[model samples]
Target: MKLFNIVSKTTLTLSLILFSQNVSQTHVYAGVENASPPAVGKTAKDFSLSNLNGKQIKLSGELKKGPVVLLVLRGYPGYQCPLCTRQVGQFITSAAKLKSANATVVMVYPGTAKDLNTRASEFTRNIKLPANFQFLLDPDYIFTNAYGLRWDAKNETAYPSTFVIGTDGKVKFAKISKTHGNRSNVKEVLKALSSSS
Candidate 1:
């Protein structure tokens, strides 16, 4: 009877452990499975997030001007992403062209709510944003998960993605990189803007 009780308790503990693991993983998988970025021909969903300056920027409001460019960055995923810096630099270098194209560039820096604003400030400390550009923050991965662009991995916040939305609110161009690189180039985004307009 003693041996049977021991075996039963061990089996019960093992079963509980497995059950708990599955329950945790189910939530993660559910989030991933439901995440789908807007397609090129589909209408881009409108969302409002606060910029570093505590000002709220709405997608629909930006689209009211002409076109909107959305850039999703891996925000402070343990550290600033080098690839994101290079990509944003390229866009900054061609700021004049983007302004000429009448496109409002909105970059999303996503991370946990803890110190997100500070991290975003650090990311842009040395850089000057053009008049046509805006840096937005996604606290606790709210916007990231909403757009289905969450990386959901170790030391990762959000996937590096880019989208050009036309005045009609439809996505004209979209590029999502699974890895750190393969980001959308400024020239490509300019072309997409030109055609969209």
Candidate 2:
């Protein structure tokens, strides 16, 4: 009887451990498996995410002003993503042209809620964003999941993505990179903006 009791308890403990691991794994791949990125010609979903200052920036509101350039960045996956930095710098350099195109650049940094604001601040510490640019934070990947742009892998926050939305709220161009380096360039976005118009 004593040996049988010990075996039963051991089996129960192992089962609990396995169950917890499965739950965690499910969370890691959550949002990406069932959804695809928004396709061109489709109406992009409107979402409201706050910048570091906690002011909400709504997609529909931006669209009302003019065309919108939406960028999904990998937010604080252990550290600031270097590729995101370079891509944003490219956009900053071409901000004047983007403005001439009457496009509002909305960059989304998605990450866990804890320390997300701090991480976002650090990410933008060295850069001077243009007047037309808005850096928004997606705490707990709310926007990423909503857009189906979540990378859903180890040490990754989001799949780098860019979308050019026309004033009509239709997506004119959409690029989602599964790899880290193939980000949308400023020229490509500019072309998309021009074509969208």
Candidate 3:
């Protein structure tokens, strides 16, 4: 009887352990399988990326003045993505509101190094960025990988994500879309910025 009781308890313990492991894995994959944005209170790592004009810009430089909005975009996915184009247009319409809140908006375009300049320039030509806005190129997705936003598999090029960094260089707000269509609109970001202010 004693041996039977011990075996039963051991079996129950193992079952519980397996169940717990499965639950945790499900949460990580389902909740954040595709893209998980940086959480608030995390210090955003600084990076330098080149613009279409071949000018290098650093994240620290933008945050030195005030808050900054960093946007990660999908670049040259065989052709220009319509959803990305729409998102950029939404931001363009709200450029004045973003500037009034003293935030410098920087968009990062990630693609292969080959023909990167042509793709980045083509992207900018389609969007009318504000004076305070800048677009940078992330060839080979180095910056995206560092930020944990690289898709790296399947049809995805890069995960769409946004970060609002405060003057202290910490992430104030972050939103990442898991699917292609579920993005934080410009008004949503503007509301977050206003609330933070």
Candidate 4:
């Protein structure tokens, strides 16, 4: 009788352990139903991603300072996107103005999980980013899907998008560009930042 009791208790403990493991392993991303950008006035979803230097950057943490201008680039479609390069450069030129407006620019460089670090480093080899700007990598489109910005089309990685999230964590402006050359420009982003409360 004592042996039977011990065996039963052991089985119960094993079952509890398995259940806890499964519960804790709940997936972070379940993919998006549609590829629409988060609506204006909607509370932005919090996401954490690794930067070029392997440092984790969380969107909510950056919002603690002020507004955040999120740039989602078309990452590793085939070669480096010239349009993306130009867009990044344009924003970098106006970095000081953006800083004065109390805005944090968070650029998302997303691509496949294979050697993405190397690709991202190559993307920013020469251009210098200001202190208020952060370069984050979205490996395997994890962050993109989380924000509903994944452009899962042929020869495309992510939809070139821009969003302005206020300190209140509400999206003030959102733009998703389906084509390569029609991305949001720096003037519009700065304007959004200035208008954000």
Residue 167 CA displacement from its true place in model 2, Å: 0.6
Clashing pairs in 2: none
Residue 127 error for model 3, in Å? 2.7
**What TM-scores do the predictions have?**
0.83, 0.83, 0.79, 0.85
Error of 2 at 74 (Å): 0.5
Task: For model 2, give the 10-residue run with minimal summed lDDT.
Answer: 28-37
Backbone clashes for every candidate come to: 0, 0, 0, 0
lDDT of 4 at 79: 93
The segments of candidate 3 whose C-alpha lies over 4 angstroms from its true place after superposition are 1-37
What tens-digit string does per-residue lDDT give for candidate 4 at 1-197? 99999999999999999997777655433336553467899988888998887899999999999899999988888899999999999999999899998999999999988978888988999989999999999999878877777777889888899999999999999998878877899888877877775
lDDT of 3 by residue, 1-197 (tens): 99999999999999999999999967644533343456888888888998877889999998887788988888777888788888888888888989998988889989989888887788778566788798999988777776888877776788888888888888888888776788878777787788777
C-alpha-based local distance difference test score of model 3: 0.83
Q: Candidate 2, TM-score vs. the true structure? A: 0.83
Best by TM-score: 4
Q: Rank the candidates by lDDT, best first.
A: 1, 2, 4, 3
Per-residue lDDT of candidate 2, residues 50-116 (tens digit): 9888899999999988999999999899989999999999999999999999999999999899889
Error (Å) of candidate 4 at residue 27 is 4.3
Candidate 4 pairs with clashing backbones = none
